[model samples]
Target: MIDPEELGRALRATLAGFKVPRNIEIVDDLPRDDNGKIAKHRIRAHYADAGARTA
Candidate 1:
């Protein structure tokens, strides 16, 4: 299995600081659109809902 922390560490080592992401979320699957493309909007909304719940 892939380790998110290790992946983050590797990214930090190889990428410019500003280019690295601040958060990482591993999921079983990504939401897809009718055309089978990744549904980024749904992903954003899902995370937004999660953040709101926590706050």
Candidate 2:
């Protein structure tokens, strides 16, 4: 469980007045590329609005 509130507090104090990010998605690990680089495209897909789901 990621604490957005506490995270915001630390970030706010660090930056000192920059608006905190509203949607903070905390993940265990980020997608990486073959060369050991961050796969930004995969990250975007993961967060994409897949719309509402129903059981």
> Which 10 consecutive positions of candidate 1 have the poorest summed lDDT?
20-29
Over 4-54, each residue of candidate 2 has an lDDT whose tens digit, in order, gives: 888887888877564767667677988899999999998777556443232
**Candidate 2 whole-model C-alpha lDDT, 0 to 1:** 0.75
**What TM-score does structure 2 among the candidates reach?**
0.60
Candidate 1, pairs of clashing residues: none
TM-score of each: 0.78, 0.60
Best lDDT among the predictions, by candidate number: 1
Error of 2 at 6 (Å): 0.3
Please give the distance, in angstroms, between residue 14's alpha carbon in candidate 2 and its true position after superposition: 4.9
Error of 1 at 19 (Å): 2.2
Pull out the clashing pairs in model 2.
none
**Per-model C-alpha lDDT, please?**
0.92, 0.75
> Compared with the true structure, what per-residue lDDT tens digits does model 1 show for residues 1-55?
6888998999999999999989887888999999999999998998899999999
Residue-pair clashes per candidate? 0, 0
